[model samples]
Target: MISLPLFSLLTDVAVLAQHGPSDVLITGLTLDSREAGPGIAFCALRGTATDGHKFIEIAVGQGLAAVICEEFPATMNPATAYVLVKDSAEALAHMASAFHGHPSRQLQLVGITGTNGKTTCVTLLHKLLRELGYHAGLLSTVQNQIDEEVIPATHTTPDAIRLNALLARMVAAGCTHACMEVSSHAVAQHRVTGLRFVGGVFTNLTHDHLDYHGTFDNYLKAKKGFFDALPKTAFAITNADDKRGPVMLQNTAARRETYSLRGAATFRARLIANEVHGLHLEIDGREILFRLIGVFNAYNLLAVYGAAVLLGEDPMEVLTILSGLTTAPGRFEPVVSEKQRVTGIIDYAHTPDALENVLQTLHEIRQPSQQIITVVGCGGNRDAAKRPIMANLAARLSNKVILTADNPRFEDPLEILAQMQAGVTAPDAAKVQTVADRREAIRTAVALAGPDDIVLVVGKGHENYQEIRGVKAPFDDKLILTEIFAELNK
Candidate 1:
């Protein structure tokens, strides 16, 4: 119902050329031609998969209000408006912001970006804000939220129109702050172009998304672009422990600060103990035990604490609330079979570095006699370069490994297992098994485990469905694991 004259929506948009009427009343905006209508303007975005220019004629024929594109068609409709720009994506971003009345500026929005820990860090920050008696919104890989109301999320970061609309809803619902996860794909595609942030947090960079970015360097640049765009009034907090952490702040205009466990930093924490139950740390000269586990979470906690303080909250109050906070779902979530005493940990460690971190953390904390059995796989149509690396790490770190299918969308599952099998050496090959069925793989790992042994299920942690050949089927990992435990151990 947020109708605006096309001329008003073009306020901050870069216009290279214009034709036809600018007074067309636009009620909705979309990139998809199927959604085009009489009062909607179709933004002809050139995406990696498909070009929106191909459907401009169809959109216009269906009575679109206007066409925003990089290039005009051979034939122009006298009844429709046309605006040409350097980048349609960027234009759409600003237009969407204008349509939504620039809601990001109304709240203290914070964005967290990196290869890992983005979900956990932002989720924690949103929870911390609510604990401090502020209404907040969350945009993350897991879900979007306005205080306690949950909105199912389809992407790590949504497209421009949806992004601003969500923020607008938050502002209207009395939200004072918002925490969002900024993915590399979202930044490179101009999905987050027009949002204003009060602060930005960098988790860490690693080898992932090579298929989309084509190289590690491009991936790093995408992550850095988020901070580079931050205004001087905002704050940029990064992990000092990561070698590439400081690189994020070099060109950023925002106030630069750091947090680390291994070195001195603007905000530092000393890890006193790390157990399966929780982590004990000395943060700002105060020792407190946190509910989240692993060194990765220790860094996430530090990032959240730093952001809250930069937002003008008390350090002691932030620490007090952070101590009882748990991690995001499927992040090292533990499921135990009391009958057999077997422990199962489900995590979303899809990359080489993340898997190694989890395995290393388990190694340091598990009982000496406890054997780690790992079941992991790579998703189809992703960075296949990491398949071998994932298998290699699991084989080297765990007592046993199982390569299984993970969302084989239009790809052969067996072929994915073969690629993973290539990573195991002859010595380690003997301990590895390939199970094409994921549920069976988890069942087998559990049945093979001795009492008190640890079974790790990685890759698709919090997801509730399995995508195969363009079809998504209900498949919750935690639900399946619990059911298998009951049937086998009972």
Candidate 2:
């Protein structure tokens, strides 16, 4: 889609020599050899499972004009052009930026990083920005959007090449600002390298992703990379209430702004009341109302407000925009039915902290006579340490806990449930029931709930597929909940 001077713009000379420059043109850029084309440039990035070096020959034979790789092959054709670098991934990021004309530098880029709340904060910020009349591009765990076009995203943070390409498209589409969820894996992999961020937001860090990073300390270090890479003019907005928030502030060089629901912060939320509809709070001494339930959401709102203010938006205007927003897909999304008076909320709370927060929030809002019921499960082959923790919180906070399967990738669902059940110390372990089928589990939980009771379907928020032994089956909690609601109403 973008035309550039092929001969003059090609940085990897080894690629140019073999291909011969004839009206030099690169139609597209890709890292995977399978996706490469005659005119495309293949970036040979080294990954954990496979080395891109092994695929360089395939890329070259497929008519790729150049190969950007970390090391050059001795058997490589002298005519083939190769750009060798210490880190091919980082080089790919820079090349992608160059190829895209550095689109991020032209727009106001807001990046949010943390163990939790990254998706919620980015989604809320995108909505708030659009409501304020700014054409905003959003990239998160749920989806990627530029203007009206929606692209399915496989990772929370996309590769640098794709990221830069998306930003360029957003700019061409007349977008002025962009919000992105910066995941720890992306940071560790340097997928976001060579991009300039205008503002950085930190939600909170908790135990997760230990499989990839190996330890909590490593995870924290990977997350800190984003703040360390921010531009000098960037503003750092942090959740002062989180124990790790202050540590992030100490690590960043950017101008710092803090928000919290506890103690002192640049922007603070004081909860006046909590109800089924949402929360009533005073933000920075100003009365603001939100339709999002739970104290945790109040913290999320405060972070958004702090980031918006740092971007020069009015405080009251931010509140007004947020008031019109109801719920993010899969994130505490409520499903209502006239016949079934029970309240159903779908949330993406897989980790112990997230599960605890959601359950505790719902517990706080439950009527004295009403019971709290939760359906939750852990993803197979992930951080198994969190399984018992999540179970403990679920049993402790709710009257009933339905243990079900969630992304049982190559692992037995019953085995996963047993691990989680190990943490429930309650005498009423009978309250915990195991259902490997997620849909059936949800149905059973909802069916057991009374009109006054609250049912929470946790994990897999905004996700549409359920992974079982490496195959993704079509499944969505929201769609199922909508169908159940319609049936109950009818």
Predicted model with the maximum lDDT: 1
Top candidate by TM-score: 1
Candidate 2's clash total is 7
lDDT of 1 by residue, 204-318 (tens): 9999999899999999999999999999999999999999999999999999999999998999999999998899999989999999989988999999999999999999999
Per-candidate TM-score against the hidden true structure: 0.99, 0.94
Q: What TM-score does model 2 achieve against the real structure? A: 0.94
Error of 1 at 287 (Å): 0.8
* lDDT (Cα, 0-100) at 275 in candidate 1: 93
- What overall lDDT, based on C-alpha atoms, would model 1 receive against the true structure? 0.95
Tens-digit lDDT track of model 2 for 1-490: 6765545444533332233334546667788999876677788877878998999888888777667777776666554556666777776777778788889988999999998888888989998999899999999999999865799989899988888989999999999999999999999887888888999999999999998899999998898888988867999988888888887877677998888777887888899988887889998778877898888888888888889999999988898888767667889888776677878889999888898889888878877998888899999988899998898888888889899999989899999999999988857587888787888898888888888788889989988999997999999988887787777677
